[model samples]
Target: MTREARQEALERHGLVESGDGFTVTLKGFQKAAERARGLRAQGNQEAALMLALEPSDPVRWEYARCLQIDTFSTEAYESGF
Candidate 1:
């Protein structure tokens, strides 16, 4: 299908949002990344974008993998996690 068709289809029926105020937010960044990868593998760009909880793909730098990230997150810390 063409890009426009995909976009229109998603606009009518999407995965994350039901065209309502509701939106999906996946727990755990890594897990959400995996889900996005799977969605892209299955279909067109617009569909994948609409379906994936996050519109953007996850980026993990090679250097990041080597480090043990223990930085304090205000969101996580504030939640008493």
Candidate 2:
């Protein structure tokens, strides 16, 4: 997906972009996911599933994927003939 789409996903999950314009706070997402996992381990299936289905996970994935790509120099990549 495009950067805009990925950013939109992050925004939908309440993750605001940092000053660098390419990063987002991940502590909250991590904590929530951890909590959900704990709940699942404790047999709270309903709550666990509810948390698991939240949009934060998708946003996290998108953010991670973005980080893995070399997006700093689009022009260089495009001109690499």
Candidate 3:
């Protein structure tokens, strides 16, 4: 990033103190913790959803299929691609 952009980000967020080697402020650490917590919550939700689905369910089946995971496999593949 350009120097101007970096300076702007630092000033706008107030997440770090402009000092010897750039120390992280409490707000910065809190933000990081919040992000980590959110990610963990999302992972747990995904795991619970996966576990709740029957093994024979289309979603479970699709989870193991690369084409299904990456794209519109069922209709698109049948339509010839």
Which is the leading candidate under TM-score?
3
Model 3, 76: alpha-carbon shift in Å? 37
Error in Å for residue 50 of model 2: 2.2
RMSD of 1: 17.5
Please report the TM-score between candidate 1 and the true structure: 0.25
Q: Model 2 — TM-score against the truth? A: 0.31
Write model 2 residue lDDT over 1-81, tens digit each, in one string.
467766555554435556765443464355445555676789986545555565656754453334323232333246451
How many backbone clashes are present in model 1? 0
In the range 5-70, model 1's lDDT, one tens digit per residue, is: 443433332212255532323322334345446656887574355443333533332111111121
- Which tens-of-lDDT digit does each residue in 1-81 have in candidate 3? 455655555443333434544443444433433443454577855535544566556554333232222222233345454
Error at 63, model 1, angstroms:
24
Off by over 4 Å in 2: 1-25, 51-81
Candidate 1 segments whose C-alpha is farther than 4 A from its true place: 1-27, 47-81
Best-fitting candidate, scored by lDDT: 2
TM-score versus the correct structure, for each prediction: 0.25, 0.31, 0.36
User: In model 2, what lDDT does residue 52 have?
Assistant: 51
Number of colliding residue pairs in each model: 0, 0, 0
Whole-model lDDT values for every prediction: 0.35, 0.49, 0.42
